[model samples]
Target: MSRLKNLKKLLTVLRVALSLVAACTFSTVSSAALEESISQPPDDYVLVRRVIDARYFTPESVVSRPDAAGTQGSEETWPDIKLRPSLNLKEALQSNIAREITISEQDALSKVVLREYGFGQKNSLQAYAAIEEKIVELNDLGAPENLKAGAVIKIPALPRMALSEPNLLNKYNKIPKGSMYPSLSKVTSFDAFNPVTQAFTEKPVVSGDGRDGSPLVIEHLWLPKDYKDHLGGIELDQSYEEVQAQVISVNMESESLAEDYQSIPFLSAEERMIIKSKLSGQPKLKPVLIVLDDGWPNDEAFYDSRKFVSEALEMIKKRFNYPVALQHPSSQSRVFTDYPKEAFHARSIHKSLATLVELEPSRVWDDQRVRVVYIPLSTAQVYSKAMLEELVVLRLIDDFMLGARGDPVPDKEVKAKRKIARDIVKRLKQDIGVKDLSTDKAIIESALVFADLYAVASGNPYVVNFSWTTRKREHKFTHFDFNQGILVSAAGNSSLNNCKSCRPNLAYSKECECADNAAAEERWFAVRSVSNQDVVAVMNTARDGSLQCRSSIVGSRSVDPLAISFNGYVSDSICGTSFAAPRVAWLFAAKLAYIPPQEFSIYDAPDKGHKLREIVKKSRQGGASGDQYGLDIKKLFEN
Candidate 1:
């Protein structure tokens, strides 16, 4: 009996072990299947599928819509990689200190320069040796960042200070007063299939004369498709294609915005004294505008249909005499937002910057918060869609899976975006002699562009960035609605669609409705995100009319913006429509006397919505997220 019992127990243990193995195998298969079902652009990159069985994935190419419109104002180089001559720094220091510290024949130490640029101990040793010969007299210096590194600095071959950085990040500081401000500058420098040039082109400037403190008014002149032929009285050359470039810089007809009243909003443009009376203290108007040159000119966005926008600007300018203007877009930013999921990896800031420089502006204002948005000069995928399609015939990656999310990056997405980053580096090295671009190029370029632009217009102080909220897909951009944009969204905890206010089945914001058709939901989410994301920069507008979602309350920063946020209401509550951005704009104009613009692209700013909120808070009546339409204008000048 004992022997029989032992046999039974042993058999039972073996059976249990076998079942476990089967279960594990089943789980492994299931997980792989899920991943494969969603895996996008296939490995055979040569055959791109724009459609799944006759249903288009990417929208068929079309003459895109208009984009230029906004409040605005708004300009690099190549490395001549030659060996630097070595310098006996001690001797060079005897000369003019600042001049001596710059790159001269005496400072070129080939070996040291190569080493500084990271030629490795072996690769460019001889090149360094050759350059070191030129750096004869040395002016070994103290660290501008710190003296502890025991480092020697050399200038580029050019007569000016040219530098290659390879060290821990130096402490960054805000641009000091009386300095230039770099506004949101798009990508400034990068390799491209074709080099960017500013010399004469048939394309006319769409955004014109829209900068802070600029007294000039810009206007566009409607012209025929081949109108470039008549600009200089020479029918030079313009394709007889469907092209519309009618933009010109014009002068403000009235000296003060109040000179043209009755047409604009609050103050009369025809009466300057009216505005002067309102400015009890030191009152000055700094007119500005922002325009994105995404595609074709948007006539509907201007006086024709967007009369309200023009009215608003006029009202503000006339009310306080702050000038404003904006209009543009011909094709860019697509590279930043639209890469395929498998291929979309945020590379170095330098991977796509254009080398187009203009004479630096003479005066840069420092009142309004200015920020910049950079566009890469090259993405390889940008040159042509056909070329990109040919390169990616197989679909291994999904079309809309994401390359980067908000500043608080999700680990899973981060890992995936970087999965092919190493491959990107390898390709760049082979294509243009760069590796680790994600680390090396992108960040560096952003810093440089923002820094330079900031220097030009340091006056605009409190920055609200709209760069990272970018997308590549297509969707409509309806700036305001009955409710939504005006409210602070509560990050609700439920099984609802992330983007949808509630469930999908219900037509709109009827929270109780649920349309759980997985396939339809997937397709709906795949709409092009660019129009949905870029044009309508998300903002904090809850104070005046922004509704607050009960679940997601924003109470992070003390100086958080008291803009607009909604609160839990009954189903019958109709408030804080998704189209409530105007209140933020209106509030901004009202508080212009308090907040100044900075040119740096708010690179260090927390969430833009939060930053905007913080700015309002730091200002006079930015108390809390409640309605305060009767704002006090005096506290602005007091502090």
Candidate 2:
């Protein structure tokens, strides 16, 4: 009986031991399956389940793991893997972590997974395949077709080796070669005398005459019909009839009158005295009209237009004693016209000149005190699309260098920096020899051209009208003496689309809208921010006192008085803020004509906007509200 009991006990102990062994075997198999479920990282990289707090993951931080026997040990006995002194530990750890991104319409699967986050174009196909597979496994995408638009997915961390590999596609990574600007075959120098002549020095690619190697003719003298006839054979390339018709078209004569009555004869001495008496007390110095735009008409067409404009102004001076004779300093009326497409539009120049001379129907003249100077500095034909993009890239590099320094650099160093900037531009052009239309070249070139022209327009007490606007407004236009006079710029025609949130309002206003789909509000803010005492920005309004849908708004927050004018034609079909700006310029010129030279110096001082706002307020008409002021040519002549 004792032997049987002992056997039972022995059997029970053996069964218990067998149960423990079976449990251990099941646990081992389960651990293997769990390990296989989680994707393994590529060699030389560790899988980071979660990023440790950066404060605790310092260079002094140590990583600990179990011993090779897979058994936990005392803290001191566990291996401590110290980070290398040369390693950027934070960056290294961050690179190994997965990143989440939502696909954009512009994003391609290959670009996102391979070129953007994984190895670049220089990597092998096997490397790309590995990355794609890792991405699919990590996101459970199953297949490439499953990666649809707006889908969120995880990008697998890149291998450790990728950090050491240079990315050639990054423009910042490429070291610019020695003397980039000076060594280029086309670009010569960025000296103040002639900064960017790369596009101008070479013959224009477009087919046209009078673009290059043509003598520039400027018509400064406005001769009376009597003087023209006496000087006989003065070679008016345009017929007398044509000149008469142009004069009528510009509102120099009543269009309702007979053709025989259209001719403007010489004024009698009595008529001159009567006009002179009416202009008493105004400044003797003539106000300057600086037209900074694409080049004016070329050769004969240019001369004829100038002759007609001058003669028409002379007629006003003789008949009404208005200040018609424009001040000619050095006998040069047209300053810069070096581009190929200078003669593209004669009507634009004609309309601008006519607007400066007089406002139609109301017949309000610029008091005959306006002088004209043309600068052809706003044409996009000078550069290929590819060249323009290269220029922008160069500008970005320059901005980065300057921003990194964060200190005021000396003049000598500034020149050196400019040279480096030019060099980069030249090198980029060489790399991208292909010609294509640039996405943002027009805006970039507008700023560059204005900068160059600003230097040329300096030194004279002038009212400069820029019928253009650009997104780039931070350019340091050297040698531009803003003290000379004020700049009247058009508040761009970029407000066509209304902000959906601010419906029924033709344009976006800061008070009612935040942003638009086209980001036009941001652009409008940029345009308004550039305005001050020295720069007067004008917007367009319709005859009904409503803002033109296509006219950019000067936000209510602006301290500068908003100058709004009729954007539609009073005489011809021409319209836009382009026409509105010159009308404001003309009005400002009239105001400046009464201000003494000593008082005119105030424009150079800060807070000059106070005085400018006052001027705009005093001359403003009935079609304005709040901070806005509409232009009235008649109010300009008021005391």
Candidate 3:
């Protein structure tokens, strides 16, 4: 009887062990399946994929839109390797200094030069003279019109006594009796790309008659499609047929924006009152436009560029009566190795906030509050559809899913980090008065964008998948709703010489398709400009006058009198449509002062400021194209 009982116990134990093993195997298999599911493409993207399919993907074959309402037949091509123009402002100042010192945002070039190269405070005049000499040296190299931070400039080697023959550029400063302002110039030195010149072209003798138009107006320009034809008045020989391309670049016209606006309820009575109070008087009309760029110059370039940008702002304010600010945040910060490039971009944005507060004291309404947005450049170098969608998902999860419910995530450490990030984002959002980031709305007036997004995109092959297309549409929608104040964009710099696909288009053949889809999107509304063309062309849509550039994506949409300068103070030498966007932004800011209360009310509407289409309605002027009227600001603003 004892042996039988023992056998029963052994059988039970064996059965229990077997059950445990089976359960363990089931759990392992289930976990593996879950991971596999996560690894696969999300359902939305399952039907579509990136052409390059990598972290850094570049689109191949950029052709102009065949059906585009702008100039057709000329296909713009972008190359795998970019060949941009280069100018060295730091080197220009090198001969005058004993050694160069890196500059900071807060440092004044005059004071710094005085401290490093001056004899003493008693010899202030002499120090000022030395600084003047350095300024002239910079101008010769086609430096940015303003003083830039984050570059290295020279400490003049000349003794204070030697520079005492009166500062050559001192007369340019227009500060009040007690304020000391840096020398600034409206004249740009950097040779801008000229579709007419077939090469980088300089301004043909600035008009002494002075611009009669509103300083705030933005002119969109495109690169010349046929360089030889424009410059030599002779058609150039071509090797291949033109490639028909379609670029759905973001197009934010007034009509689509108006429709978008109606969907959102107009501001409440209280909100309207608040807006009225803030923007009531002309004094409140101070429009703060910001020019943002990517890429940092060498240490030497940083010094010169910082000072140049600073001085340029002052100059524009005094001469054009335009209050424009600039912020070029680079991936390379002071401690270049410490953080990722994205961090630096965030820093640049923060810097723009600081700058706004400094430029206009009233901007501190709620502890240095300022509205901000993002406007893509012509090249689409600042973003990709995949990356942009990733950002949206991250924002939704962090701001709503995880934190909105006021519940802590299961992981304590992750929750803590997210909390910190959330705080920062919340602070900025409030400052900009952004009620919700979930949809595209214009709650902010300022914007931030990178020019390199297009430059980088040029290297990848085009993807026509649903995911890519949808993301792009979403991105444009976001920008459209991001700012109620205004939208400013750059017409890309892809021209015959720089873009690989452009050469074949000289013959007007159909062999390459390198159009930028971003340029075609309809959410683009505010202002856009190119560098070389004359008479800014308005697009086919009644509200499409906003589209500008010579990429052939916009058939016959050529504009004239567009101007740009090299950011010589920042780097060895580089120029692009990216730089032109900021210049246009500055111009637009100048016109803000003239905006009437009635016109400003557009922001309070659902469409925000979409009804304010001031690009094509404005009068035109002739200069390089001869005997034509110039862009008349008085008529555009007054009308």
Best-matching candidate per TM-score: 2
Candidate 1 vs candidate 3: the lDDT winner is 3
lDDT accuracy of residue 5 in candidate 2: 100
| Tens-digit lDDT string for candidate 1 (4-90) | 999999999999999999999999999987654443212111110011000011121111112111111010001121211111222
Writing each residue's lDDT as its tens digit, candidate 3 over 192-256 gives 33222123232211111111110111101112223122323112111111101111222111001
RMSD of 2: 32.8
Candidate 2 local Cα displacement, residue 491, angstroms: 1.7
Worst 10 residues of 3 by lDDT: 46-55
Q: Tally clashing residue pairs in candidate 3.
A: 113
| Model 2 lDDT per residue over 458-487, tens place | 322456676655443221122122434556
- Give model 2's clash tally: 7
Ranking by TM-score: 2, 3, 1
Cα TM-score of candidate 1: 0.24
Model 2 TM-score on a 0 to 1 scale:
0.38
